[model samples]
Target: MKTFLFRSMIGIFFGAFLAVAITNCAVYFGGQELLDGETFLKNSLGSIFCGWFFTVSPLYFELKNLRLSQQTALHFMTVTILYFSLSFWIGWIPLHLKSILFFSGMFLTTYAIIWLSFYFYFKNIAKKLNQDLENI
Candidate 1:
């Protein structure tokens, strides 16, 4: 539970950061005016909620006896469904085919990079543990 909370909080922060950055970029490029404080807060809160949804999958899949590949597949599917659904709901992404395709591609690529990075990180830790075990 502690780990879950910690991870979720981290996700929330990360998501908020990305949301703000993206919004700034949009405003700059699209020549849109800055959002009102209430609107910005609402959007940020929604983003944090979406972030929690995104992070839950990884924690849920971290069970014993599951292969890394299986975990990755499950995570991918869960994030795919949750992200698209949430984005559509929040109007961050349009429900049109072109928008869907573009966002889907971006999401998959980003998640794949994240998953691989975590995979290698844990693999290195496991390797270090095995070395220590061998020395004992």
Candidate 2:
């Protein structure tokens, strides 16, 4: 519980940092206007929750009974649902069908790239470990 709380705190801060950075970039490069106080607060809270979820979600992989594929699928689905819901609520994603579809594609592509990167990274580590063990 303590560890979980600690991670959650870290996640919240990290999320806030990301939200600020992204907002700054958008305002600077995209000519987007700064959000008003109430809207900004709402978006920030949503981002923090997203950060918390992303941070703690890896804990799901620790479940012994579930295969890695199952864990990945569950995590992906959970993230998708949470992100879409929050995105819509925060007005980051417009309610139009075309906007939804476009964002969904972008989200899935980004998720796949991240997932593959981690998958290969850990697989390389495991391979190295196995090779080291064989040399012992």
TM-score of each model, paired residue for residue: 0.72, 0.88
**Which lDDT tens digits does candidate 1 get at residues 3-68?**
888888888988898778878987999788867787677678778877787777787466768886
Question: Which ten residues in a row are the worst by lDDT in model 1?
Answer: 55-64
Model 2 / residue 34 / CA error / Å: 6.8
Off by over 4 Å in 1: 13-42
Q: After superposition, how far is residue 114 of candidate 2 from its true place, in Å?
A: 0.8
Clashing pairs in 1: none
Clashes of each: 0, 0
How many steric overlaps does candidate 2 have?
0
